[model samples]
Target: MVRLDRITTRGGDAGETSLGEGSRVRKDTARIEAIGAVDEANAALGLLRAQIAAAGADAEADAMLARIQNDLFDLGADLCVPGAEATDARTGRTRLRVSDAQSARLEAEIAAMNAALPPLASFVLPGGSLAAAQAHVARAVVRRAERRAVRLAAEETVNPAVIRYLNRLSDHLFVLARRLNRNGAGEALWVPGGARQG
Candidate 1:
């Protein structure tokens, strides 16, 4: 149980923030950037959830987004500490790290959702019902988070599962967006040169 009794700690007044293992790094470091991207994705998911609730779109999607929101926090925690095998010195317990099971769960969900959606004849244009559009936004943000994590991986020992989770999450969001769009009924598919004047 993590406690945050003080929200306005002057710890980062020097432009350096503490890592999970008590090491301090600049606020703009790759690790922090990756973590910040994940946080942004989580916020996008929150907005998607609100759209879902307001539109009364799909209860199942709301539930799924809720779970994914929690997972993003786990991802942020994993990135906050350096190294895959990092463990807490005081607790002698492994730090919170993403697992293959998490990505696999996302794969399963994506498969289940895609199974019901009609085959796409054209590329999606990222617009549909409000909830679906919000899902698209969340998907784009998750992709950005994945790119940031990949950048961090190039420089540090990032967990492989972190990348996998983000990758699968974007796909999961894409499929879920379709599901939210009435199983592709409300989806806006792109038409090649449809707007061109002949």
Candidate 2:
């Protein structure tokens, strides 16, 4: 329901961006870094989703990607909040926070997916079908985002759910990659030297 055209105020041309609290800071600040990493993960997912669509696969993956995109927006809102709420008096939008239930949902999904995948015996190189390989790339980015959020949490008040979500998301991506690789035409490759260990 938000209008798009009138929102960009051109106030950030000087290397500063506005937070939810109306205060401006350098674009490279910890808050921005966390948000940026999330955005990157979202974009990567989008790319993989598009490839899936092109392949005429089932709609499940696309549907999930759409949901994840929405969650990323929520995460950005949570990150942009100055403290716990917005500063603008006209709009009563509050700061973003992740709930325990959301984190639990991700954990549940990871557990279900990991249950189906075989145990890893050694470090594996990341590549597979185009979509699956892209998923792996997104997984790596999600891990980086998790680390960045952890650092941010150390310095400021970040929602713990964000960290939990990132951790689970990386695991989700790994499973998705393997599943996609199992699809027709996918050629999943493992590290040539990898051997299962008892």
Tens-place lDDT per residue, model 1, 1-198, is 899999999999999999988899999999999999999999999999998899866888888889999999999999998988757667799789999999999999999999999999999999888888988999999999999999999999999999999999999999999999899999999989988957
Q: How many residue pairs clash (N, CA or C atoms closer than 3 angstroms) in each of the candidate models, in the order given?
A: 0, 0
lDDT score, residue 41, model 2?
A: 90
List the global CA lDDT of all models. 0.93, 0.76
Task: Find the candidate with the highest lDDT and give its number.
Answer: 1
lDDT tens string, model 2, 1-198? 546787678887899998866788999888899989999998998898999999888487678768777777787777777443334345765445766676676667667656766666654457767788888999999998898888888888887778888887888888777767764235445656458543
Candidate 2: residue pairs that collide: none
**TM-score of candidate 2 on Cα atoms, chains taken together:** 0.83
Instruction: Supply the global lDDT for candidate 1.
Output: 0.93
Q: Give candidate 1's error at residue 115 in angstroms.
A: 1.1
Q: Each candidate's TM vs. the true structure?
A: 0.95, 0.83
Best candidate according to TM-score: 1
- Model 2: residue 64 alpha-carbon error in angstroms: 1.8
